[model samples]
Target chain A: MSTPRPLTLIVNGEPRALQVEPRTTLLDALRERLDLTGTKKGCDHGQCGACTLHVDGERVLACLTLAQQAEGRRITTIEGLAGPDGTLHAVQKAFLAEDAFQCGYCTPGQIMSAVACIREGHAGSAAEIREFMAGNLCRCGAYPHIVAAVQRAARALEQETLA
Target chain B: MMDFSYARPADLAAAGAALAAGGMALGGGTGLLDLAKLGVARPVAVVDLTRLPGLDAIQVSETEARIGALVKMSRLAAHPAMRAALPAVGQALLASASPQIRNMATIGGNLLQRTRCAYFRDAAVGSCNRRNPGSGCAAVGGVTRGHALLGVSPHCIATHPGDLAVALVAFDAVVETWSPNGQRLLSVHDFFLLPGATPGQEFALAPGEIVTGLRIPLAPVARQARYVKLRDRASYEFAAASLAAGMSLGVDGRIADLRLALGGVATIPWRARSVEAALIGEHPTPAAIAAAAALAMREAEPQPDNRHKLALVPALIERTLTDMVGEPA
Candidate 1:
């Protein structure tokens, strides 16, 4: 059972092959095997939202997901949100402008979750944003700022789609 | 987490064989993986059940709703027609875990989820009977707030910690399972077992059997239903006490049928049969609803810390019924 098996993961639009033990979490695979450390490990378990990542376009807790379980799925981390030209995503830009974080520890997870919230049409208002993004815990008490950023980004993204 | 080998079974036979070889079935891996990391669960071989085909379909017919075991929690919660048909199912699902978890957790996994007792999760914590049988129940005396009052034994008092099972029990859902012998249908009420003396044996799934799907009869009571979850926070947390109610009233203002089930207050998703029996054929009032709800907790044995649930459960039922059906003048 301790033996490592090879598995290919399509992360950030590129397929990367790695060997991982069946017990190795997807969070560890991203940080240790691929050096995609943008995804922080808060609890290294599912308790904290620090390891939330997109699996096949849906946000999921990577810490609870086995690396082998994600073999056939497309995974997107915090690093994949920005463009190759280093252009920040709308949510990222809003996060920076609104100072949606204080210590910036939970920022990556917050931003990734905010992106999905808007994409899922759950960022319609302050209350909606708060309810939808409740999974990403911000211990810095930046919830008000986080809500404001989601609202700002949601409007901007809507305008971009309209434009 | 201990190292384990993984397998993807293409069909039921392969899954059965995998289970026969001492492999634990992995659904969304939310509960199992979390427990494995905590050293609560250690499976030498892991059988990934998500990749199995024909088990992800969500079919709603005129008379029934069949939800495959592999159907993600969010997938069913977001189904428009299903939501309109069986509202309690969606309500319970939405009231459950965070959006990120709902996206990954499967219905089958939710049904068989382990208790959320802190003693069960922490390896170095006080003695936990559920984690290691006969170790002694830590929740019995220490921090008994979240412990079960409805189905408590000296051995275990762990709450079921699931909302879907509560609503399924209310609407007469059937547990559909598959094994080498053939398909078997067990009522949701009988699927879950009480701790009694053996807290380790929780569910009624036979060895090497797999839960294929859940069959819910679209009873008339299901047409009008409500789920009220009272928790510390609004979302992303387990319920302190939750109620799922489905009621139908005749034109004469008398109750035609009523169904009730409670969560977060019982060891299993508890169907309040005595409560339902008291309300049937009678017009609902706040006082009558209050008294009827009391019948559900007749056998409750709450500790000093959790005695508040005695007042909370009846209030949830009374308020939900009053809001659903106006008092008969």
Candidate 2:
């Protein structure tokens, strides 16, 4: 057997060094080796947003990113968005209130990308938010609800700041 | 998917050396990794360019904007400089795959992404000329609605699948590449080639060369440019037919200059020089644009399933150009 490759990744605010195959994607590394299975593997290809995560504060498809290329970068998975005392993030709360998911397979990616969308100021219009979030495929056809959730989250966050 | 050795190079020189040392250069990996997972591309070693410094900047100036090959399409589309310098490029990027894929896909990778031909995707087909050279092209008599109407050869009829590259070609973009020998630049029009008789060799890059940046010359015409992609679906689907047109009209409402390039209908991004030549110095009326578009589609030899493109091409061009010109004064 060949020697495994050494990879150091900062996942969910923690640094981890592991020996993995060169074919290990960041999604696989998070799910298989590090046991952070919150990031789903919907298509395993880049087509689906089930593997979306924030790398260096920008949304990226973890399914296409190599584990070895993530060195020294801040990776924010779904698990990282919660408070220290385990309170839900604003986006997650809005999603729950909006009933944004049915099967919930794509909820994590949707919520993650929704938070980024609001933070990036792309939540101005429903159409714009829909266009921005088109990458994360929710096969359950929960698009209307998802968009409503993102809008609600943006409004709630704005009100909190104003208060 | 077979495992391989991976290396992260620090700079273009190091990446070129790594490529010369028999490692496949990986950029974005949206295409390469997908092919690898499908068991199509199994390189012995991979050279990752994610950490390579100075290759991700989108620099804009009065004359031009040099887009680093590693610049993600999402960032490129969202960049204020790109929005101001060339809105057509940003429009094309926005029309591409969802925001998630754009975030991970790079400009260079977009240029080099493989075709969406089903036969080519299925390794078991065993007759895709692109996958296995000299294997008969199954697309010829098969479901050829997505096949090329221009630049179709006996060997292959796969259409080039990039929207932004088509617009870049119309903008007269230059591709800068780095190799072990040295650096070289190629016009975007020449970077992608028609398959002709040999469909295996798709791009013009040398074995060890890596695309460093794309230089898009700033032209006043770009301000009035448009990239219109018509497809079965609004998102995630490849173009059924598309047009990238940039034009400048004279004071008399006539075409002073024009650059028209097409995608989803050719083996390469089809630059309609004939149409552009005819449109220049002509009135920007629907009749004139239609006549030029007719000239553009004169040599199109469409497959049985794609003959609809012959009609769609002209209409798309007219609508796209008209939209760019806005209502007549």
A109-156 per-residue lDDT for model 2 (tens digits): 998899888988899999889878888899999999999999999999
Clash numbers, per candidate: 0, 0
Write one digit per residue (lDDT tens) for candidate 1, span B156-262: 99999999999999998999999999999999999999998888899998888999999999987887887889998888889899989999999887889999999
How do all models score by TM-score? 0.98, 0.96
What is candidate 2's CAPRI-style docking category based on DockQ? medium
- Report the C-alpha displacement of residue B143, candidate 2, in angstroms: 1.3
Best by DockQ: 1
Q: What is the per-residue lDDT of model 2 for residues B1-329, given as tens digits with 9 covering 90 to 100? A: 67788888777788887888788878878888888888777777899887678779988998899999889998899888778777889989989987777877889888888888778887778888889988989988889899898988988998888899889989989999888778899998788877887788888988779988899998988877778899998677789998888888888878888989998998888898998998899988888888888887889988989999999998998888877777422
lDDT, candidates in the order shown: 0.90, 0.86
Q: Which pairs of residues collide in candidate 2? A: none
Report residue B222 deviation for candidate 1 (angstroms).
0.5
- Per-prediction DockQ scores? 0.79, 0.71
Candidate 2, DockQ score (0 to 1)? 0.71
